[model samples]
Target: MQIVFYARVSTDEQTAAHQAKQAKAAGFEIDVVVADEGVSGVSTALADRPQGRRLFDMLRRDDVLVVRWVDRLGRNYADVTETIREFMRRGVIVKTVINGMVFDGATTDPMLMAVRDALILFMAATAQAQTEATKEAQKAGIEHAKGREDAYLGRKPSYTRKQFDSVVDAFNRGEAVAAIHKATGISRGTIYRIRDNRGQAEAALARWAA
Candidate 1:
């Protein structure tokens, strides 16, 4: 049985090599590497990915599959849960680098199976919830940016959309200007500008959101 590592990179800055290095650092005896670069389909099935399909073909009963996290298996809760369950059913052990979790189907105990299944459900649900939250935050920032862009203000916002969102969120949370600056790595002057003129700042963020 092979010990395979799967790396899925969503951004250009993320690298399979780096993930492999991390896995090695974690003391996983990796025998093979299967990677899908720039693959971030929120609803895509693991079987559908170009390299993801290779997993079904390569993995066998008792083989160990390692990933950075449960989220890397799939994006949505259903997909993640189903994929892990399927692998477990096939006697393939699923291991995660983050916490050294091992999900194996070698046992015949009913109670243990019940507990494992419940844990899988909880983790998958958490991953999906996080994905939804990120999309909402991005949407808010984008809308705010568009508002500023249509207004055609000459003084453009210096901060990126992410930075603008951070500043806005910090102020709305009643954080001090100095605290916002420190947390978001933005200048005090810019944080004050974002705080003092909320609408204008959002408009700038919305424009950059596009």
Candidate 2:
């Protein structure tokens, strides 16, 4: 029963190594990592992605599949729920790094199964909602930039909102600057800036990722 870490790096700012580190920090000893880079989870199905397709073929009964969250499996509600259920049916244990959530099909209790399924549905819906909100925010930011007298929107932040959040999370977890830099692919200078003035850094990120 090997543990596999699956990463969907949808954006330039996202990195698979960062996620793998998170999984390790959460006490998971991963044996393999499959990553699909430059893939849009919001638009692409897991099985349709190159690495995602490989993932389906590679997983075996009793194997463990680890993801950053339900969204990494599928961004939308239907896809997320279906992907999870399919894995469960195949005897693959699904786990998330975010909350250390485990979805295994080793239960016979009807009520417990119901609760688990409901949680999956809720998490899937929440993932979809977050995706929609990000899209809307990006649209708003672009429109706002276009309407501005100056074509420049400040420095056009070097990092995305997700990267900024990752740094903050690492900081809160007591990770050092170098580790955060390695995990996020962000520069030491930027991390220091964030450390010194988190409020200002967040304001800048909000404006850019608006």
* TM-score of each predicted structure versus truth: 0.73, 0.74
- Please state every model's RMSD to the true fold in angstroms: 6.7, 5.0
Estimate candidate 1's alpha-carbon lDDT, on a 0 to 1 scale: 0.77
Candidate 1 lDDT by residue in tens digits, 25-74: 99999999999987874767788899999999889999999997787787
As for candidate 1, its clashing pairs are 144-202, 144-206, 145-205, 145-206, 145-207, 146-206, 146-207, 148-203
Per-residue lDDT for 37 in model 1? Answer: 84
Candidate 1: which stretches are off by over 4 Å? 150-207
Task: State the RMSD for candidate 1.
Answer: 6.7
Q: Kindly list the per-residue Cα lDDT of model 2 for residues 1-210, writing each as its tens digit.
A: 889999998767778998898899999999999999988888899999999998889898999999978878877789999999999999999999876788988767999898999989988898787666555544555555554554455776787777875676556445789988987898999999977876666555555653
